[model samples]
Target: MDQTDREILGYSRYVVLAAAFSAMFIISPFEYAWSSMSGHIGAIYGWSPEQVALMFTTFIIFQSVGMLPGGMLRDKYGPRWTTAIAGLFSGVGILSIALGPSYPLVLVLWSVGSFFTGFIYNNAVTTGNKWFADKRGVMTGLIAGAFSWGSLPFIFPIRAIPASAPPETFFTVVYIMAAIIGGVSIVAALLMKDPPSGWKPTGWVPKTKAIARPSEHNYTVSEALKTGQMWVLIVSFVLVSSAGLAGMSNMVAYSNSFHFTATAATAAAGGIALANGFGKLTLGTLSQRLGVENTMILSYIVSGLFLFLTIYAGMNRSEWLFVCAAILAIFFWASLFSLFPIAIGHYFGEAAAGGNYGVLYAIAKGSGGLYGGILSTMLITQHGFPFAITIAGVMAIVAGLILIPLKYSPPIWKDEEAAAQLNARAAVGRR
Candidate 1:
């Protein structure tokens, strides 16, 4: 880093973080709030459960696909244009959904809106790595946590809107939400300013122990794709995310199956949503002390155990156990938002953090939504909820196992000799 860029640029980072947080919070309802309207929308259109759920799948798939271009935009053009475009697509597309006639038309419009939302999401997330490189884990957790928890305020109001409420009223609310998301995001985007390249906080030294350091070389998107470690992390992320996404999509219905009242089921789902945010913050911070790899391993193992316990709780008619276990399972699952991005920055370096992490996040969540949404739904139909839960739990455990190789061979593109030596030592330690 040049001497000019070496000095602390003051507290401007906090401003950037706040902007990212605000944008994430406003845009979040687009994804997390879908469950609130899914049943109603389905009923209104006389669609089957699979058809209603397909909307969510469509959202996830297109949003996931969008992250690649979104990240590339953030890398090349910065957050301002990316987020502004996000505002346009999300706000206008959602508004358009209210007027669209056919279900197929709604799906197409929502996907377009969802795609731009990815731009908002990636730009917001990349802020942490770009601005607070030293505190990537914590910042990413907080920002992503906002995305998770942002839906809480709307969940009840959305649910309370009786199924009999006019469709116009329902969509009117969506319009207001779309406007808020777009407006806040645009203002926040204008407020955002990236620190000069290679910037670091004044007097802040990089930490090597406990937390992983930036990669030895800053690999571009193409370069990052070449590394074996990148592919390993990708697979691990997909597996772990699948388990979590499945749980998230079905938590309310699962709770209802235990015969919990409508209010209680919603409460439980809301609690899990809230816990999801805190889990990101807690585990993300924990990674600083426990090492990201170790934290992820612990998170998956414990999450899987709790998910299995959920089955036991259900069989015993233990609502408390079921709720508690479900919350904890989601807590750990949500931690991936923090862990994966930090790993990406560590593996590929911050220069390409936007694009590299974008592609990784897209693939993981897109594929995960497939497993979690469509496949888990099929499993639930075929073998029952317990069987579905068991599969998800097993997937979590496997994700942890996959990450075990990472400790042995961290990605280090610039220093082959050093990485090899470390790999050798890790291999010996394994024996």
Candidate 2:
């Protein structure tokens, strides 16, 4: 293909990836279910609120542990196999949520499914960098936005008003979620595959900030572990992740602190996910131009600011206060989620990225565990959302500070000429 044609194809390929991920995201209605049915399920099952809440935390923990295996799968057979299997798992998981024997058992079973929750999106990120080397920032931004409340569309099917329906009404909601998510997820998994090496899409430029040839830029898991970049990446991902979950676990309370009604709070909570999706798309693309590190720093810092505002808005009870606070939260939280993987592939060779990232990704659920109960108790005991959110906001801001100094790190790959020289030497070694 000609130059323009190749660039167009490259853009098209990246677009295809984003669409696939968004669809893969379509079936994950569980995030929305917490607020949607927590009360109903708790009331009918005679379960304490804390016990039911623990299920969401359980889901996150399993999801994190699951990333280790998932990341290994991504490396062994490539993303298609991992994503397809995950889609199937998610389908079964959701189906089980639809039909439950006991609330505690259901939570345990459903939490098991959260393990596969991230396969599609993470694969899209790792693979998209391979395909769109030239425009990662823009691509990352688009990814950030596309996935922000990826489950937003699925909310309608599962949203049952309190007092409006019997507890058994939840069965219908689960059925709707399972069908919608299961069908789309399976299709998305079927369509997924990584581009063959040397298959650079048209119009794409393989621009690395380094002098090493692209192929020569090999950072194995061990090598990656030795670098400040790895630790920086880890610190960056973990800090932001902790902050986002803290806010996520408490957004309902935060929303109402400002006088928003239950309907408005629920709407706001769901919107955070949608907004986070847009943030992923926009910020992911923006990272392509500004550099992933820079973009990520911006996201966290801005998120931190918005989080502070959320507290103030909650305190003051202003209507317009959090209108944009929620949007910014989406931007920063999703930005961290969407771009860090791209940067990982950039710094560590793709071969080692899976394992190295697995360690980082797997640890994320533990942060949920730490902050989930800890933050909740502090809030209930300490008299408000402000103290907890303030701590998280501080954490998010810290992520920005930690990542900003990463600009000095060398680029992972160089131009073709150097790569050929390395390839020639390797050929001799083989002989």
The most accurate candidate by TM-score is 1
Q: If scored against the real structure, what TM-score would every candidate get?
A: 0.92, 0.83
Summarize candidate 2's per-residue lDDT along 2-52 as a digit string, tens digits: 443235444456455655566545544555445555555666667775776
Which model scores highest in lDDT? Answer: 1
Q: Candidate 2 — what's its lDDT?
A: 0.64
Model 2, position 338, has a per-residue lDDT of 66
Alpha-carbon runs more than 4 Å astray in model 2: 1-19, 140-146, 156-160, 206-216, 257-259, 372-374, 410-431
lDDT of each: 0.81, 0.64
Cα distance off (Å), candidate 1, residue 387: 1.5
Clashes of each: 0, 34
Q: What is the C-alpha RMSD of each candidate to the true structure, in Å?
A: 3.8, 5.8
